[model samples]
Target: MATLSYAAKDSRTMVRRNLKKALRYPSLTLTVVIMPIMMLLLFNYAFGTALGSGIGPSAAGGGEYIDYLAPGIILMAATSGALTTAISVCVDKTEGIVDRFRTMPISRASFLTGHVVGSVIQTMTSITLVIAVALLVGFRPDATPVEWLAAIGLLALLTLALTWLSAGIGLVAKNVETASNIPMPLTFLPFIGSAIVPPESMPAGLRWFAEYQPFTPIIETLRGLWLGTGIGSSAAIGLAWCVALTVVGYLWARRTFKAGAKR
Candidate 1:
């Protein structure tokens, strides 16, 4: 009981440390917010009409392209912040910060916990900003209060899972550049999913991949919750993906951290 309490305190301290670092150097956080807003504007104003027509009437939630595109772009906001986690972790490792932390009388678990918690907070803030922009640009959803809560919960879960994965990547990366590039696929994977267009519009091979990928179900679930579309089994599948990813990431990061500590 006492140990758990101490661990919690240590983790909070680390979270504060990371959050302060982020405030002192706001570039990464700004990028996380800006990139999604850029994509949202580009797609909504530049190609909205053409793409909206291409997606057909039913797929666009019977409304403008922004309505259909908002959920996916919001998910992009959640993902775009992942790169910062990997880079920060790598930078700490390369700068011998981890070595210094090891000598401190702090909970070892708090190191990664701090990074993940701090990141989730920052990423969620970015998501909120993106959502505000989305609303400003006519991205309206018919979601109820309960649905909004559920959607927020799911986004938080996804952010936590991705942050852990980024931590693992940082642990194993040979350099900061490698760490930064490794999570790039995650940032853009939504484009290949049901983000912009439905899988029905894709060729057979690409459609198969898009349907089975993790992001598609998640986006579908969000769409259903926000736009009154059919969720089917997407909510369950998305939750499963979040749990599976979180488990895998946690195990991988724990193992890698332990190995580094031993060496």
Candidate 2:
């Protein structure tokens, strides 16, 4: 009972703290909200039409190009949030906020939990906005209610995994600027994979990379869920990646935090 109470209390406190920070920085919230939508609109209406004709809508999965692209955009939005979370954590560490927290009697997990929860909430809002814009531009998900829920569950898992990875970067980043730079590769990774366009259209070398990369599996799983398509090995791969990354990142972050505490 005490454990349960501690868990509940920690969750509540963390969420409240994060929300207050978000409210204080309205511009950050706006940036997080608008950037994803802009990327969606720019890619879909502008570039998608040109690429759609060549890929042939059917070859690209028989759906509208925007629909095909929506999953990637959602993932991109989540990635952005994760990157922001890492940078925020790094900043807090440098600003002595983390040190202050370390002095408290609260659970160490509470500090990380609050930031991850806050980031997930922020990412979800960004995703909703992107989806709304995608709808306006004729993107639609054909999945049933259950499938939709599962898709959302996968996204949440993906977000949590990435947030943990980012937290590790935050714990070790030499400075705030360097911390933000760490997630750049991940931010650009989806674009290189089959997220925006099918891998078949790319050069053979690029195709190989796109087909084999972690982003492909994630994008594929999301696409299948959104479009009500048959599940493939990609979903399994995505789940594996999420599990592996989360475990490794959690262990590393904990170790780094412990070392930092001694310093």
Candidate 3:
């Protein structure tokens, strides 16, 4: 019960801290909000048609490329924000803020919890902004309210998983600059998957990666939910990826935290 209480309190405190920071720096918050929207607009309007043409008929089949790309953009936004989380945590570490927290009576989990919760909230905001812009640009999910909720739930899970992974990197990184670079590979993953184009049309080797990769399942699951299609293997694969990443990230973060505490 003590552990659970710590987790709850830490989550709340982290949320509060992040909200205060965002409120104090409205322009920074606005920049975060605009980046994804701009990316989506540029991709859909400027390059989507040109890219869609190369992917063949199935790519442009539904005439709803924006809807098709929404999930990917959402994932990308979440991934992008995670780098900020890592950099912020590293900044805190460098400024001796984390060391100060360590000396206080605060629960160990609370320190990490606050950052994770804050990062997740930021990711959610980015996701929502991207979705809103997608709607404006002609993207609509056919799912019911419940399905929409599930889709959001999946997105939240993915955000948390990635955030935890980023946190681990932040804890052990030698400097702020390197910490910021850790999540770039994750950010580019969805692009290589079926997010922008179907995997079927790719070369054999590229198709193999697309078929077996975690991003494909995540994109497919979101796409299936949006289109009201049948629940398929993609959902299972996505869940498996989340669970695996969560476990691995937890262990790595714990180890990194322990090592940093010693230092």
Model 2, span 123-193: residue lDDT tens: 78777777778788888787889888888888888888888888889988989899989988887788898
Name the best candidate (by lDDT): 1
For every model in order, what is the number of clashing pairs?
0, 0, 0
Q: Compute the lDDT of residue 124 as modeled in candidate 3.
A: 91
- Itemize residue pairs with steric clashes in candidate 3: none
Residues 151-188, candidate 3, lDDT per residue (tens digit)?
89988988888888988988888799889788778877
Q: Using Cα atoms with residue i matched to residue i, what is each candidate's TM-score against the true structure?
A: 0.99, 0.93, 0.90
Error of 1 at 68 (Å): 0.5
Runs in model 3 deviating more than 4 A are 2-7, 26-32, 54-61, 229-231
What value of lDDT does candidate 1 attain over all alpha carbons? Answer: 0.94
- Evaluated against the true structure, the overall lDDT of model 3 is 0.79
Tens digits of lDDT, candidate 1, 6-28: 99999999999999999999998
Ranked candidates, highest lDDT first: 1, 2, 3
